[model samples]
Target: MQTSSFIGAVDIMSTQTATERPILHGGRREAMREAYPAAPQPWIDLSTGINPIPYPIPTLPAECFTRLPDPEAATRLESIAAAAYHVSDAAMVAAAPGTQILIELLARLLPQQRIAILGPTYAEHQAAWARGGGSVDLIPDLDDLPAASSLVLCNPNNPDGRIIPPARLRALADHLAARGGLLVIDEAFADLADRATSMAATLPHPAIVILRSFGKTYGLAGVRLGFALADAPRAAAIRTALGPWAVSGPAIAIGTIALADPAWLAATQHRLTHAAATLDRLLTDAGMTIIGGTPLYRLAATATAPDWHDRLARAGIMTRRFDDHPSWLRFGLPADHTAWARLAAALSGNRPPLANHPDQ
Candidate 1:
């Protein structure tokens, strides 16, 4: 199931595995082409945690795209997002293009010598910290968290949905705060988690910063909306750093409407829960070991994961495959019945039905 790739740069056998797997982020259709040129068309991409069913975008005003985003309109969007997230104060939330922006800036916000990150979580946190000249330590166990100037971790983490309780996190925050340390929690997958798990509603602390990704839950990544929840001072500093019009008018308008729709939120959550259950069964039946992940995606462990990745790629069913953890494959929700059928056929090693085939 495992294969080797040689770069010949060094004779050393590095477990880094960058050559054996995709080194970049998922949903790379062009990379799929380089690997499997003869694969069939209509690729069913289940490579990201993005919701398969996106929020319905409303008709935008001409001014939204043509002119600069109004400060008042941005404020309105922040207010609505604050309400949706149960954040009491709109000032505590700083809107940006996406959570990725916040993640990159966090290292600079808190000048620290050592940054302890809980992993194998999101790769960006480590990369960002390293970029900002912080020595990064990867802590495998929660109990073994090292005393550091700053800490970064994910709540309901990516690749695998791992959550730490609010009370426990608060205690960690208190511990970090005593030593002038900062704790950055990425709650990107927290939407699918229970309401009690979110710390967004709670009073902000100077030592604690929470990041929420609107694109993942709302299925509007192109809208490029995300927020950083922190104390008044930190929020203000972030906003100042971002400057005016960091988010576009169209993003503000679309994000506001989507966040305000409680009915759509409830229905989508319900539908996603059911869909996740269906996906779990399919993966298990396909001879995979369920590892972790939320309703938006499922992480499965298999001995033949690399082979399966190649097999599915050849069938044009693109999934998120990890190089570091070679056994893991993350499957996002299929958009529709046809997508589901295609995935099932690919998993079963059967050619998809020929009707309307892209190559045919």
Candidate 2:
């Protein structure tokens, strides 16, 4: 799927040079507002890997907010997550407001030394380590990781979906564990990709910690729920660092229900797979080279990625472009047929059909 049959055919303003724009993250509609004041209403945001069709949220009991989060409910949520992730022990799971918080906590908990992060990843790992006063390095491959006291990487990586074999990662974890070092694996997108690549199924190691994001897969980022899978001591340390009531009552209730619902998971997986394939077809039809991505999103390599991005933005269709990788652009799956047609028309530089009106 790297090269497309429609290459050099679609007129996406490919000849026009686009002005360099500041890097912006997905779901930041306000940023888009400032960038494109009169583009359109209800922007079609395809910059993030989050599922466009969010899970159906259950109505919460009033007590979810009136009272403090129950420790037992939090425990139950962790247990559900543990079972969902195939964690060997429920005690190994620690619930947090978000995995971003857990990443900071891990950076603070782990010993300060050379921390190597697999390159071109979610930028927070390096910043979080720096915030915790830990030294950092961005290594391109796993072979260059031995010298670092702690190594962090996103499995089924962000922007471009790259996955490291579980066995190879486990060997690295064992090596780091033997030296009292840490190996952090961010499995944010693993829910939609190959689940076997997750370290959750592996036996707990003193030096290994896996961060699982509940929001991305479940499409409830507003819930701010995430989990850390680690040995008891490390899990306890993260809990202690986050303090009491680290996760809200509503979050626990929602996470427990969502993670435990195997039926919903299966259905959503199928829906996302179908949606991703549709997105691939749409992008390829627009002459973009689909390099790689998980079911949640597609990454394209193109000589005129910037121009395509600009054209799309003008049409109120937002996609992610990397500052470092000028030729690369990432597109998340559109929510419905209307959004699909809207993006297709934007990329092809044609007006969206009136019948397939863009939804707000």
Candidate 3:
């Protein structure tokens, strides 16, 4: 049997290793099936903190598939995104399959620099930096930020779902700028409601680069569209680094229509707000203490997060658990009443408490 080597040193294991591991995100009905061959597919997947009710996908033009994306598609998408975010058209935006690629491109462009990343957050930032020959420092606290050449932060961080305030971020940017360092803020989840809280509009003192993902906000993860916002020169640098035709024609078409639709944006926010609150109350009533996060999802723990996750899985429900901090689990907000009921029932059942608190 042919087998592949581990992708990175992080997976170097002394013990036995598997041929392949399931990808961490939800929508893993097939993997779940492979793991438990007899089990039914999950009724609801609350693993990813994605907006449940996505912005309505409109009819695609036939030309989107027939023709290659024009170079102008990137420019038009940027213009539409600027209007939506209330930023300048000259802010310089570039789209890729997703923000993940954009991040990798950034890391590659600055390979010699030391990169500081906020901890217990997205693992890709570290992976991308390491892949590009950049050393990474995990900053658990804002004060721990090293004198690195670049910093990456995930606002309203993943898994934990805690929002780092905008003012604090701005201050950090100022500090980094004074030291001649750059800051990259991944605000993929902030669009659920806190759009105004983003520093993307300000073009602040520090060479701050903001990343926004369409997958989380517009529920277009499969579409694989994301953008970077930065000043003209910095944006030009990243653009030069990325080269041309980086974004797809379908992505450009969908993003332009979606960004221009205020009605869809407003409606999604309202639906997500209501759903997230309901999910929070349901988890809280089931005896879990809600730690953080906004209307899109909630982070909670009652000591038995792992056990609870397993129990929920057995009952055909899937939620997200953190590798770095096992005590915390994240649940994506359910879109409708049926999903909410399923999740509530899973939580209501009694389960044994965890023996040791991971956070402690």
Q: Which candidate is the best by TM-score?
A: 1
lDDT for 295 in candidate 3 is 68
Show how many residue pairs clash in every candidate, following the order shown.
Answer: 0, 0, 1
Report the number of backbone clashes for model 2.
0
Model 1: how large is the Cα RMSD against the reference?
6.2
User: Which stretches in model 1 have alpha-carbon errors above 4 Å?
Assistant: 1-23, 349-360
Query: TM-score of model 2 relative to the true fold?
Result: 0.89
Clashing pairs in 2: none
lDDT of 2 by residue, 83-192 (tens): 99999889899999999898778877775678888877787677767668877877878877658788999999886789999999999988888877888999999997
Lowest lDDT sum, 10 consecutive residues, model 2, at 6-15
Residues 6-35, model 3: lDDT tens digits: 111121111111223322445655555454
- Better model by TM-score: candidate 1 vs candidate 2: 1
The TM-score ranking, best first, is 1, 2, 3
Give all candidate RMSDs, comma-separated: 6.2, 7.9, 4.8
Using lDDT as the measure, the top candidate is 1
The segments of candidate 3 whose C-alpha lies over 4 angstroms from its true place after superposition are 1-23, 204-206, 353-360
